[model samples]
Target: MQVALFTILSSLTGGHVRILETAYRYPRRPTFLIPRNYYVKLLNMLDTYYEGRFRDFIENNTVELPPMEITHFYAYPKYIYDAMNRIKGDLSYFDLFYVPHEHIGMMMLLKGVGVKWTALLQLTPVIGALDVDLPMNPIRLMSLNLRLNGMGYIGDKLFEYLIAKAVLSGETVLSVSKSIPYEMRLMGLRARVKVLDPGIGIDEACFSCGDKDIDLVFFGRLRREKGVFDFIRVLNVLRRRMRMRPRALIMGASDDETPRLVKARLRELGLSGLVDVKVNLTRRELLSNLARARVFVYPTRLDSIGLVVIEALAHGIPVITYDIPAMRLNYRTRAVLRVPFRDINSMALVTAKLLSDEEYREGLANEGLRFVRRFDWVNVALREWEELGKIASEESKAPETKVANVIKAISIA
Candidate 1:
């Protein structure tokens, strides 16, 4: 059976593309739908799919349409609609259209074009809360939801409406964590849902038990929601308690005002000389550095799952993160040092204790390495490929009108 993997993103920066890169390993040989001018150079640079049995169908010149950047929200649906309309062959030639992330616009357009589709749902912070990270005010949150589900409104930007459309159009809905699917059901999604945990590429031998040169390491996007400010506070507490400079490494995307704010905070805290801030490191570089790091600190507030935490575990590095639901879902064993959310002092104390106690840290590292060995990327790809086959066969004859009606009922709830 033929399938198409669609991504509206310009590059494979997050777990969304990591899933695609791993799924390409199976024998399905799905065709990838990428923007003609987007992610071309990045795909070549990544080189994970070079030897895979997959084909690329770049969306270009499908119709006489105006140019739009791949980063734009509306550009993807427009490009996909034109591509499906202008294809030389029959639409039935492709059995399924699989999107690794929630692209409501793309799903709606694909449904209109009579293509069966599946979507992978990972809870996004802003939309998952449906209140734009508002303060703890129940009245305000309920009022916002009321406006979102009100009548005479086009279902474009509302999370409930967009997700309802995607769920209605999708033949299957795969969630990375169990909590995400539960949350969707609460939001009125009645589609067939499955839990598929994300996998890592690291092996047991990936860890070297090396020099442990870096004292503390944090790897992810340097955004405010990632608890970058909180990380800085933890570092300050650690330094004051230890009475010395604590070496830390931060490697991730430094877009927007993050870099400026990080540097400013570092200067304000007098930590500019102790911290090493790097951006856009290759996977190999990240793993290499991780191997020599002592502790992995993930203070994120919005990640569905901390893949970097798993990577650190694979490298025999103990992790210190918040007791977020996503982390609890990801970690099955006593592998991580979980502290209360946003409690900088608790985090600092745990980090300091882990640093001081060598035997305890190594024990957690050993347990983590054993636990993560089961989640190899190949195993994950194989399971997803099997599920995809099942979805393709089982839902081949499913009626679109039935799913649409279900969504219509849910959207009004």
Candidate 2:
């Protein structure tokens, strides 16, 4: 079965791209659609996965796929219209289209275009607010309310579109979080929904237990949403209350200007000397840093699935994060400690306690290691591929031809 993967909006640091990269091991090659410049950089980043016959790419917005050849297209609903046009005006050649829930516009459009596709759900903040009916943290609730109010008319149309798509598309829905399937159904979704947690590769040999000298560590995008600044504030409070020069490490990829902003904030908080910041480290470098850290702190205000949290757990590092609904619903385990949203004092206290209490920290670390076993990338790839095989078998009539190349449009925002 020939399959194509296209994401209209691609992020160098995003989880969706990483998931696609992991799925590259499947027997049938899948083409990627992304920007040409990013394609090279992304290939270099995935050097470990390069096996000579890597999937091909088509520069962004180029409708190059032959409608008579490819069987199915697994799309992340960023640029659906362009992709549909790429099929040489033959939607039937693409038997199944996979859509992420966040792309409500694309979902609605596909239904109108009379195409076959599945909805891939990632319970983001908007869905959490609309579906789960949980008491959100004050800040997150406020932000959600503001966004909803701001998008009043457009939001209504989008949901109407999703409901229509749900009724029209008799395809299955794939979700990463357990709560998403239930939420989608609650919203009158008619399609079958399956929960498949996207997994990460784990090699115990790659990750090591190093000296726990680093008191606190946070990795991933150095953006405000990831709680980069909030973490710095928490460190300041922890230093004052504990009255010790606690060491902190902050690492991840960021825009050219973000590093300057972060440094300015660090200096303003008098944390420049106490905190060490780095960006764009390779996989080994990131894991190495994770191994050295005693505690992993992620104060992200919003996240569908915190992969970094699991990575920290795999390294047997205790984590402290905000009590967001997604984290509480999906991974509320004894393995990671949670503080109320925006409560820097509580976050600081927990970090200090973990640093002081070795036994308690180790206990949580052990539990984390056990909890993370379920997220092994092998299990993820198998389940995902199994579903793909079933779909391909049903569409065996699809003609065999050279897979389409990838085109990436959006850059880092």
Query: TM-scores of the models, in the given order?
Result: 0.81, 0.75
TM-score of 2: 0.75
Please list the residue runs of candidate 2 whose C-alpha ends up more than 4 Å from where it truly belongs after superposition.
35-41, 44-79, 89-93, 123-171, 182-192, 197-206, 388-413
lDDT of 2: 0.61
RMSD of every candidate to native, in Å, equals 6.1, 7.8
Per-residue lDDT of 196 in model 1 = 75
Over the stretch 1-413, how does candidate 1's per-residue lDDT look in tens digits? 78777664444455644665565566766666655544454445455422321223222212122333655343455566666656637567777778877656566555545567776765531234231223434334434533432312334345545445444544566766655654444454466777876534544346566788898888877876666777888999888776757689877765477878888889998998889887766656666777888888877766666667777888888888887666766686777878876788999988888888889888988999888777677777777777777777763544466444543443344
Candidate 2 lDDT, tens digit per residue, 1-413? 54545443234454654455445555655544444445555556555323322334333323333222121222322345555666645555554655534555445445445444555555432333331234555334434533532333434344343344443345555666665554444444455666676534454443468887898998878877678888888888887767868888999877667778988988987889988888877666777887888889898765666778878888889889887655676776798888887788999988888888999999999998888777766667677666755654553221111111112221111
Off by over 4 Å in 1: 44-76, 88-90, 124-171, 186-188, 198-205, 241-244, 396-413
Top model number, TM-score: 1
